[model samples]
Target: MLSEPTFSFTNFQQDAVKALLSSTGISLLAILPILILIVRQCGSAHPAPPRGCRRLGLPPGHSNLHDEFDPKYSKGTSKDVDDKGQPLWRVKALFTHPIKSCAAVELNVADVVSTGFAFDRQFCFAEQFTPDQASTSEEKTQPYWDARTLRNGHYSRLALIRPEIWVPDPAAPDYAPDLDEVRSKGVMVMYYPRPAGRGLSSYLVKLGIALRLLPRELSFSVPLVPPPDRASAYPPVPVKIWKDTPVAYDYGQHLPQSLREFLAPPDAGASRPLTLFRVDPTHHRQVFRNAPRKEELGFQPVTGFADAYPLHILNIASVHDVAARCARDIPRLSVRRFRANIIVQGPEAYAEDHWKRILIRPTGAKSDADAGVEVHVACRTMRCRLPNVDPATGIRHASEPDRTLKSYRRIDPGDPTNACLGMQCVPSVQEFVIRVGDTVSLLETGEHCYIKLLKPGEIVEGV
Candidate 1:
């Protein structure tokens, strides 16, 4: 038998303490400070884990656990306004959807572009359809498809497909990425639930993933930026979106077979083949809704593939107000269902309804007027049943939020039949980076009537 030796100071310390107490005639109260100091120095028998490690279920330095209000993002101080002392609203959140109707990528900072956010609505899935009888020879060789999104309940499953934007890290100070390199090197990785049939093999696959022996989800990657050479070979084709037919590059040849099968599975009863498309930069489709202010704004704003306007801005408080009116059985609502690019806080519920023009600037700037980038609140975003779909679970609600919103939110003059939830916006000419916690100032407020105008031959391809 092996014996282990243990060290103890009990006897020696007790004898020493007795000798000291007797010789010095010191009371327990007199030595209390000394005893406390010794215990503190010795610490516990076992050292504790780091503060971050003590958290349950989350790894250290997780992005969700990170503090967006940290002083570093605001240049040492979190001043909401400049020297003017004007009241301002803070940017609550920033989101970019690299692919339309798919999951959004939450960002601490986002790059502003002429149309919208740098990567917002840059890619979309389309369903191939037959061309019109007036199509020319070129149309015969190349066919255009209709843009498919979560607006249609049949394709609501798209919300489950999570996309991660992988791009080159922006340099310091300005923190602007090289546009060309960002497009060339950028990749959008999408992950979805396993689409394969359930059987012995499927069970084994799921078991393997559970044990960390296999990849958790099925995934595919698409280039964030289309290569010029490949784009040229495809030739720009027209894709339909609502009332507009914008020319775009169809990357059907580049998409993987597995992704295609997953999107339109044989058992799912899909009517059309889903394909990927990127907006053609040269083909301009001006925002007809902004025509009233085009001359006053100097340039007409455009969009890549958004339904109407370039940017969609939502007020967090407004979403909460709508959710509050829902029935008790409904799940807790999230702001993500609305899918807005810039989400602002500090404003009253539905306060954006009267906003005409707004300015977004850094935390503390010298001038309030000229420091921030001006964004025009074009019109009210008409509500649709799309919001009925839950983003996290990709499950469609019977009718809670959309039903609640329509009951009291029929406020838009242009589209009085439908309810309004958010504001559609058009940004300024110059590009800028919008960081979370930046200040938002209401520049102008006025009545707005939503409008959708289609030119004579705008919807036809090769007109």
Candidate 2:
């Protein structure tokens, strides 16, 4: 009876405290070895490589070996330009068909998902006859070694000159003309014709014969159609996007208005307009009136314009500014020579000069948060002598009244040098789809950049 006497509350509390102390003691004993092992491992571990080594592969104590291979150009940083307490505005557009001039599609929004545009100069017209700089053959095909050798100065006459046989047909299922017929007709027409000494009149006459093969008398269209499904037989080609609008090719100072007007839909019931011809705006200066002496033409000269590539880029702002200045004098100065693919509306005049890259999306694209396009800012478009030529009078001079070329002192000031800020993309048939209202995000790739249209200048030591 005494042993069973009672398990009171005090007894129960003592028993519980003893059990807890025993469990904690066992747990600590088991964890001590593990904790010591972890500490030892951590202390003996090697340190990670420096950040520069991880990124640029320049390890410490090996600077001299890599100095010779270091990049000399300036890579632009990512920053936004602010204006008047408001977020700065940026614009981006795509210019496809690099080789074929006067055919561009505008993208409001585009996805710069790759290094190059989707459809970049996929098609180009090669003259049937090759030019023999060594021979006296009137029709000589220039060598196609690289883009550097294809100087605009060497082919300046081709600007307003059209392919006598090769004409684009807008009405055709594909915009390109029938090459077989173009070749046949072009050969027949030009075989007996002699090369003209001054203007491009003879080239135009031959081009008319080529236009007969195309719908609406147009000349050519790029043959970059996508295949049905994913067929193995098809070539692995870049994706492309085509625009109905004609691309403009600037040959020095000649504005091919005939080509622009020809691309336009027939007005009411008028005959199909000629696709390739010249437009001379009377208000501007004539830069090439005295076509460089025969000797100067052989050695390519710079236009003193700064462009990433050889061609000039024209946006709405630049064109509008020119129009406003000439409104009193010429009232009809259109943006013809500044052949650019994208025509942006926002930003002040020449604002694209400061951009590094641009982003865009096509018109009516789906509203997916991740669905937009981007384009890297390769170069700034600079003014050139093309604007100095008075299209109306066909007069060429460095000083012309009411000339917009004066606005760009860097280009027209003293002697005409090819100093411009525009970017020149390589001529390829890579195609890309772009649209209006697309956001352009610019990023500088490098500082010591060269224009695509012209060859790089001799690398001289610090000026």
Candidate 3:
């Protein structure tokens, strides 16, 4: 054993070096095939995702939707121009909320009322009633009966148009051309309880039965003129919205059981009861137009359960611009986030800011362009955290759109805090019908007066 290890140190070192080089060579050879495979895959038409993977994309305020059309081509989708050389800013899409804040119904054509789009925000939900000292708790058990109410405008979440309720009320007018029904019957968002055995038969499912949506024929939030006995029968109710406390008519007395439930939340444990009310047809809330010159735009319409204006118009480019300003890749922003009654394509990003008045014309029509519906671009729509809320998914973005917008698009550049996109609009004519694929012409151009005003406290957030 003493003589056993009499080997030379040099020989041992040489053997160790050879073993290390051989191992290194083997490792490189094994990795070479993998590199070749990756290179081959890269050359293919469609690169395959790794096995066992799901689709992924950026989230809100971080990503953008890849659209094919050129944003500046205002001549509608294609260059079919009107006699005027302006780009055709065609109506990319048209949507109507048979029920405000709920899901919107895509429409080929929709009529406009003095208040807003046909049947939009005509009937909104309120929280359940918790009777005050004037009434007893027994009222909860009574169905289709008069009781105290907590109007939806009083609370944001309750008033929220839940995308979860995306399905159109089957009772609404048929998708086919049915403006006649709108005039003859009028639209009401009704809720019919599922039959007793069918389940959900209660005013609210939490009411021990389930209820489904039903579109009924009822005129609401219009004909500002009150009934002769309105003073005594339909007492003026105190509902809060923004800074104004315009008197609202208590609509509960006339509505059926189905209408009451449809306008109230299903929360069994809520502290308030759903009380239906109508917009004060006589009163109008003025938007604070922060312009150096005092220009008087005629009577503002009374907002019907809407924030401040009757209708809101948004541009797809503006939304995309807001997303691009975001720091990360964002998910495709749905038109629902804008909650716009009208979605217009064409015009560069934020171009609507300068469009003070726009005429919506039928697509490809040359002579009837001027006769088309004219809308006044009232003001830059001031924003809050509302855009951060995804109406489609009901998911809230912690930051963005608003965060990115604050950096660029300010409602009042002087304030720098107000964020806005799109324009608050009201139809110039008393009544008109706007159809999809309509072209929007810039009728009047003016600087957007960023009004230095604050929406009074106790304001509810929108979806």
Give the per-residue lDDT digits (tens) of candidate 3, residues 1-463. Answer: 3656678899999987776579666665655665455445434423222122221112223312234234443232443554675445777666655444555555566677766776565444433333452243343442322222122222322223321111222343343223322332322333232222223233322322121122212222221224443356566665544434455666656555544434333542334455656555554344433311223435445456666566788888777666556637455555566667888777776778877778887765668544787777877887776666655444557765677777667755544677778788866665778876787788888776554435455332330
After superposing candidate 1 on the true structure, give the runs of residues whose Cα lies further than 4 Å from its correct spot: 1-88, 131-144, 169-185, 327-329, 367-370, 453-463
Number of the top-ranking candidate, with lDDT as the measure? 1
* Tens-place lDDT digits, model 2, residues 64-109: 2122112221122233443433223333333433233322333333
Residue 288 of model 1 has an lDDT of 63
Ranking by lDDT: 1, 3, 2
Better of 1 and 3 by TM-score: 1
TM-score of each: 0.73, 0.37, 0.56
* Top TM-score hit: 1
Scored by Cα lDDT, where does model 3 land? 0.52
| lDDT (Cα atoms) of all candidates against the true structure | 0.70, 0.33, 0.52
Write the candidate numbers in order of decreasing TM-score.
1, 3, 2
Question: How many residue pairs collide in each prediction?
Answer: 0, 110, 28
